[model samples]
Structure formats: C-alpha cells, structure tokens
Target: MIRFHLKCDQDHAFESWFQSGEAYDKLAASGMVSCAMCGSTKISKSMMAPAVSTSTSVTPPKPSAAMLAELRKRVESASEYVGSKFVREARDMHDGLVPERPIYGEAKPHEAKKLLEDGIPVLPLPFMPSKKTN
Candidate 1:
C-alpha cells in the first residue's frame, strides 16, 4: 500500500492509500479521484516526503484506563439507553417517527450495517451500554 498526498483544483489537500502506484494511476485517469472537500474530480498528486524509519519515530500514547472509564460514564450520562430496541428506535428517529435524540444500545452487526447503508448515522460505542452491563 502507498499513501499519497493529493490536492484538488480548489487547493483542498487530503491523503489516501492505494494498493499500488498502478492502481492509483488507473483510478486517477478514470476520474475516480475527487476533492475531499468540494467533490471536484480534478485531482493531482502533491509533493510528499519519502517514508523513512528512525529510532525516533514517535508512537502515539495510549489513553489510560481511567480515561476510558470516564468516557463511558460521560457517554452513558448524556445518552438514553435503548437496550436491544436500538435499531428500531434509531430508525424511527431517523424517519421522523420519533423526535431525534442521543441514544445508545446493543445491535447485531448486520443491523448496524443496515443502518449505515441507509445513511442513518450511527456510531459504535467503545464499551457496551451501561444497561447491558452485569
């Protein structure tokens, strides 16, 4: 995989990974590449520094367990726990059948995929909803 720094006609910059240089060429030539900001298809590769390895390559610090537990608490406090009716409640809210509100709950993988495919914006919480905790 190769990561390329790209710029659009509007000067919007973004990076993307491709299987290979040939793959990137094929996609770009076919107008598949587009500006991440404005959706313009006029994309071009920008100059990028070569990848290098050094002992000083920084690794991002991991968040502490306390931080995660605090996050879980804050999220639970801010959202309603919908238990397993998550999918129905979320879909209902999306379709305007119910007032839109923050909710968290358990959902099967397939159900989550269906919601995303339908463009109903759902995100996975790092921890299970508190209602389901033992």
Candidate 2:
C-alpha cells in the first residue's frame, strides 16, 4: 500500500492510501478522488519529498552509556519516583484525584497497556538502568 498527500482545487489538503501509483492516477483521472475537507473532485498530488534510503543501510549512531546515565539522572531529579505505586499514582493523576506532576516508576507491561487503553498517556523511559538493591 502507498500513501499520497493530495490537494484539491480549493486548496484543501488531505491524504489517501492507494494500492499503487497507477491506481492513484486512474482514480484522479476519473475524478474519483475528492478533497476530504471541501468535497472538491479536482485533486492532485501535493508537494512532498521522497524518503531516501542508503544503499549500504548505514546504522544510526547510538548515545554513549555515560550520556544515557546522565539523562537518567536528570530525569530522576526532575520527576518523582513512585516505585511500585506507579500505576496507582498515574491513575489518580489521570482521574484528577491527584495533582498532576512529572512522575516516573516501575509498572508491569499489562498495567501500562491497561493505562494506555484507558486513554491515559504513559511513556516508557528508554535507556534507564535498573536500580541496584542493597
């Protein structure tokens, strides 16, 4: 499947997915494509740059461990560590039961999924090392 950004004569911009470029051309030629916003049939491909892929598929450079550690330290200082009560605190904040503030902690995979399903914003902290227990 291919997606194309389309614009109508009314200058209404929208996107539509097509099976192929030929399919898009056929649809546009037949005036089947219409603007989603203004309902105009005069649709054309909008200006967009093509994504260029490297032939050798060069891997992007990753941040050093020290950089990640420093970032983690900064986040820990800025956000409250709720530990095991992450889900409860997150739910409370989502429901307006608790004052909203920056928080970070541990949560089970299913618990995080449930929160996301419930329309709550939850982001996984990447490159955060586990705390060492005494």
Candidate 3:
C-alpha cells in the first residue's frame, strides 16, 4: 500500500492509497484520481517527505481512544444504521430508488469497490465498533 497526498485544482487537499506508483500514474492519466472534497479530477500530487527511517527511535503520534470513541459516536448518531443492507440501501439511494439520507452500514471490500466504480458516493468509516444487537 502506498499513500499519496494530493491536491485538486480548487486546492482541496486529501490523501489516498494506491497499489503502486504505476497504479497512481495510470489512474491520474485516466482521470480516475479525484478530490475527496469537491470531486474534481484535476488532481496533482502534493509535496510530502518519504517515510524512510532516519532514526531508530522516531515514533508517530497516536490518536487518543476518547477521540476515536467520540468520532464513532458522532457518526452513529448522525447516520442511519442499515447493517448488512448497506450496499443495497446505498445503491437504491444513488439510483433514486430510495430517498437519499445519511447512512452507515457493513459492506464487503469488493462491494465498496463496486460502489465507487458505479459512481455512487460511499466512504468507509474507521474505528467503528461492532453493531449492538438488542
């Protein structure tokens, strides 16, 4: 996995992972690379230092557990939990078969990829706890 920081024509900055430098190049050339904020295809790689090790003791900052928990809470509270129906619900909404609203749910990796390929906007939320069943 290789991550690259990118900027769109509107100056929206975001990061995305590609399979390789060749993959990124191919995508960019084909206009597949786009901005996360504005969905602009006019993207360019931004300056970022290589993640090579300069010292053995260097460490990255870790996010607090409380912060992750808070983020998870906010996401759950703001979105409807569709559970396993996530892919279907998202597709329905995108195709105008259902009303569009904030939603969150489980999808297989391939499902998410298919959604993107179909131009249905979907984002994966990080640090999501298991869905509570009652």
Candidate 4:
C-alpha cells in the first residue's frame, strides 16, 4: 500500500491510502477521490519530505501560542456548544424539532454510533473546551 498526503483547494490536508500509485491516479482521474471536509473533487497530492525511521531522532515543530489561540477562537466561533447534551440536541435537530445548526460537544462512543446509525450528521471536534470557558 501507498500513502499520499493530499490537499484540497481549501487547504485541508489529509492522508489517503491506496493499493499503489497507479490506483491513486486512476481514482483521482475518475473523480472518485474527494476532500472529506468540502467534498471538492479538485484534490492533489501535497509535497512531503521523505519519512525517516524512528531510530533517527527528529524534532517536530510546535504551533505558536498565538496560532493555537486563534485556532481555539475559530473553533469556538464556528460551532454552537451543546455541552453534554450533544446527543439529545443532535437528535432533536435531526428530528426537525430544533433548527439545524453546526454544533460541537461531548458524546459517548455508543451515542455517536447511534447517531450514525440513525443517519444523523455528526462529527467529533478535535478539541473541546470547558463549559466554563464558553
């Protein structure tokens, strides 16, 4: 298998695994490959440095505090916080009782599975701030 670092036009970076380079080319040419975030068909491999073995020590650069703060702000502003009631609120919205809106919150793994099984759209946030912060 081969792994490619891919980027969409929106600059969302992700990785895709393929059987081979030819397989990737075929899928991409046919528009079968798309960005998970934006559903954009305009995807391409991003340039990446060759991987080194774990035996070779390498230091990864950390994001600046300012950058992290900006990211946290963006996350907070982009979605509504439903807190621990994520599953209930999500179900309500999905059932057309509450108006649908972008939301982020905590849910048990089983709750998430149930949401998926029910065909309700939900995605876990990478980070969740404390309720007091909101």
lDDT values, one for every candidate: 0.75, 0.72, 0.75, 0.71
By TM-score, the candidates rank as 3, 1, 2, 4
Each candidate structure's TM-score, on Cα atoms with residue i matched to residue i, is: 0.53, 0.51, 0.54, 0.50
C-alpha-based local distance difference test score of model 2: 0.72
Worst 10 residues of 4 by lDDT: 125-134
lDDT of 4: 0.71
Root-mean-square deviation (CA) per prediction: 11.6, 15.2, 7.7, 8.5
Q: Please, what are the lDDT tens digits per residue for candidate 1 over residues 1-134?
A: 57899999999887776656765776677565655456677899999999888889787456567756766766676578888899999899879999877678989999987887776666566676667742
lDDT of each residue in 7-123, candidate 4, tens digit only:
999998877666567657866775656665666769999997776688878875665676556556665665678788889998998798998675678899899878867766554
Q: What is the lDDT of residue 57 in candidate 2?
A: 80
Is 3 or 4 the stronger prediction by lDDT? Answer: 3
- Give me the displacement of residue 83 in model 2, in angstroms: 0.4
Question: Which pairs of residues collide in candidate 1?
Answer: none
Q: lDDT of candidate 3 vs native? A: 0.75
